[model samples]
Target: MNPTIRSLVVPVTDLAATKAVYSALFGEPHTDESYYVGYNVNGFEIGLNPAGNGGGPVAYADVDDLDAARDALLAAGATERDAPNKVAPGVRVCVLADADGNPIGLRGK
Candidate 1:
């Protein structure tokens, strides 16, 4: 599958404050939930996650096959942080950590 970095997730300490900041910056959120807030900017997604890494932001690449992409990462020395899980009706996401323990996310539909 061709990988495209379509999303960038930022870890937030305060969801409401973070959402407001991003809303002002991005002109409003397309997705607003207790756990996540998503904004669409020129077809790219910027997400705020309450349960994100404190270290830094996580970048997500869009893939045609979530499992295949995840497995390839694992084979290349990445460790599974979260298995493939359905977040929406047709959307599936998986999180993995590189050798240095940095988080990377994969999203598929």
Candidate 2:
């Protein structure tokens, strides 16, 4: 599958403060939920999550096939940090850790 890094998610300890900062930086949020806030900037998505698990930001690649992309990553020595799971009706996301334990996110529709 051809994947592109279209999203970047940052973990925040303070949701309100973080949301305000991102809102100021990116104009306004496209999505505002208790768990996640998303902003669209020139076709790319910037997301903020209070419950995010990783140590730093996660870059999410947009993929046509979530399973295929995940399998390919695993085959290439990436460890699964989170299995592919549906976040919305048609959106699915998975997390993988690189050799250095950096988190990478995969999103599919």
Candidate 3:
């Protein structure tokens, strides 16, 4: 898959404050909870997470096959930051770190 950034999960210390800020910009969140707050702007998904990458926002690229995409990145020098985990019924996600330690998020099956 192309390096198409479909969504972003921002790491925040305070969910309530961050949610309020994003809510003002993006309006009501489609999914809101203590763990996550999600918004859909157009076809792009934006999320807020308190326990995230521990740095900046992570960009998740939507793919058809999560395993293939993740393996490709790992073979190309990326290291696994987080193993594939199911976030939703059909959606699995993972985070990998590039050579320079930039987080790469994959969202798909």
Q: Which lDDT values do the candidates have, in the order given?
A: 0.89, 0.90, 0.92
Give the RMSD in angstroms, all C-alphas superposed, for model 3: 1.2
Candidate 2: misplaced stretches above 4 Å? none
Cα lDDT of model 2 by residue, 1-109, tens digit: 7789999999899989999888888987989999999999999889998888858899999999898888899999999988888888999998999999989899996
Cα-based TM-score, every candidate: 0.90, 0.93, 0.93
Task: Pick out the ten consecutive residues of candidate 1 with the lowest summed lDDT.
Answer: 51-60
lDDT of 1 by residue, 24-90 (tens): 8898899989989999999999999898757688888999989888889999999988788898899
- Whose lDDT is higher: candidate 1's or candidate 3's? 3
Q: Report model 3's TM-score to 2 decimal places.
A: 0.93
Against the true structure, candidate 2 reaches a TM-score of: 0.93
